[model samples]
Each structure stands twice: as structure tokens, then as C-alpha cells.
Target: MKVYLDNVGERRLIGRADVPSEAGPVWIVRLFGSALIIKEHYTIGTVTHVPDGGARPLMERAVLLARGQPPELLPGWQALAP
Candidate 1:
């Protein structure tokens, strides 16, 4: 999944991802082979990854939270961005 900062600099879920029913620290499982466990005190408008697989196996992953507006493409393809 990809994350981006909205106009007000709030962390907004973008790309192919889902938000939990209750906010705060939580782990999210995607349809494919990627996941993220957000922390309670994590910055709202930023991208983060669980460094060493606290909830899943270790894998090389990178996420680019939007600095402004999200890209105008369909889901599942945003990860290809640098």
C-alpha cells in the first residue's frame, strides 16, 4: 500500500489499502505479499515500515507517502513509483 499527506498534512490512506474500523496502533494485511503495522505515536503524514517483521516475515520493502496529492492511477500500480 501507499500513503500520502493530504492538504492539511494528515496521513491519508492511498493506493490499494484499507483502514481499520478502530484507529490507533494496528496491523494491516494486504491482498498481496505486503503489510504494515502502524504505531500509536507515528507521524500522521508520513510513510513507515515495520523494520524487522514484528508481525510477519522479513522482506525488503519501501513506501512513499504522498507529499501532496496522490498519483492518478489505479490501485496495485502505485508501488512501482520511486
Candidate 2:
């Protein structure tokens, strides 16, 4: 599945990764320096910091989280608006 990041102005392709074995579908969102992994219909939102110098991994994690897997926590990646 493809997950799109809404940067307000334009959507960006953050990363692409295979979905988790159990997770059916999910949506992952990253803004500022926080990452949020959400199920398609779930409402609660949790924000966590990404690690330093971890752009690629964070992107991959975002993709995985979008696919319903637990996000791989990276503490310092920043999301810039388009």
C-alpha cells in the first residue's frame, strides 16, 4: 500500500516498506519532529520523537507504521513542510 504525507501544500513520499505480517492497514503521520502511527479508523493520536540522523529509517518506519506495524522509534528526524 502507498501512504501519503500531507505537507499542507503538497503530499510527499516519505518511504516505502513492506507491511507487517499482522497489521491489515494503517496510516503513519510525521510532523515537526514527532511520529504518529495510527490505524485506519482509530482516533487516538500519539506523538513521539524520532532519533538523530535517522531520516531513512524514520521514513521506512513511517511506511511500516502505515501498514499497521509498531513504528521503529528514531529520536530526531525533522519533517519540513512543502
Candidate 3:
């Protein structure tokens, strides 16, 4: 899946991480330049531009938590897991 980060003027390709699933399935999305980490749970999403470097981990966790769920869609777009 590809995500566009308009703020950074770049596009991010999202895919599954190439690791064993003893932990569980995970979904990953990456964007270059001015990296900002965002996590969404339920209806609310949060964004963190700090340099703590926790975005990837948080996204993986979100995927695990959302396993077996249907995709989410807004008015004009849909969010599908990869």
C-alpha cells in the first residue's frame, strides 16, 4: 500500500515486515523526510513529531491489535491493511 504524506511532500510505501510471527502479524508504513509518527486506535488518531523513533513499533502494535477486523473508510477514502 502507498500512503502520501503531503506535509513532507513524499509518498510512503507500506508493507508487512519480513520477520517471524512469534510475536504476531504486523503492518508497516514508512515515509522519508521530516518523519512523524502517528498511531490511531478506534476513531481517534495521534501524531508525534518527536525524535523518539517509536513510530514503527507503534504501527506494528496497532496492526496486531486490529487483527481480523474489517477495513476502515472515511467519506472519500478507505484505509486498507497490507
Top candidate when judged by lDDT against the true structure: 1
Clashes of each: 1, 6, 0
Regions of model 3 farther than 4 Å from truth: 1-41, 51-65, 79-82
TM-scores, all candidates, are 0.24, 0.23, 0.20
For model 3, residues 1-82, the per-residue Cα lDDT tens digits are 2222222433232332222334233333323454455433221222324347555433322122233232232112234465
Error of 1 at 56 (Å): 17
Worst 10 residues of 1 by lDDT: 38-47
In model 1, the Cα lDDT at residue 64 comes to 32
User: Over the stretch 1-82, how does candidate 1's per-residue lDDT look in tens digits?
Assistant: 3444344544444443233324334332233343344222212223444565576443322233435433433234343333
Per-prediction CA RMSD (Å): 15.6, 13.8, 16.2
State residue 4's C-alpha deviation in candidate 3, in Å. 13
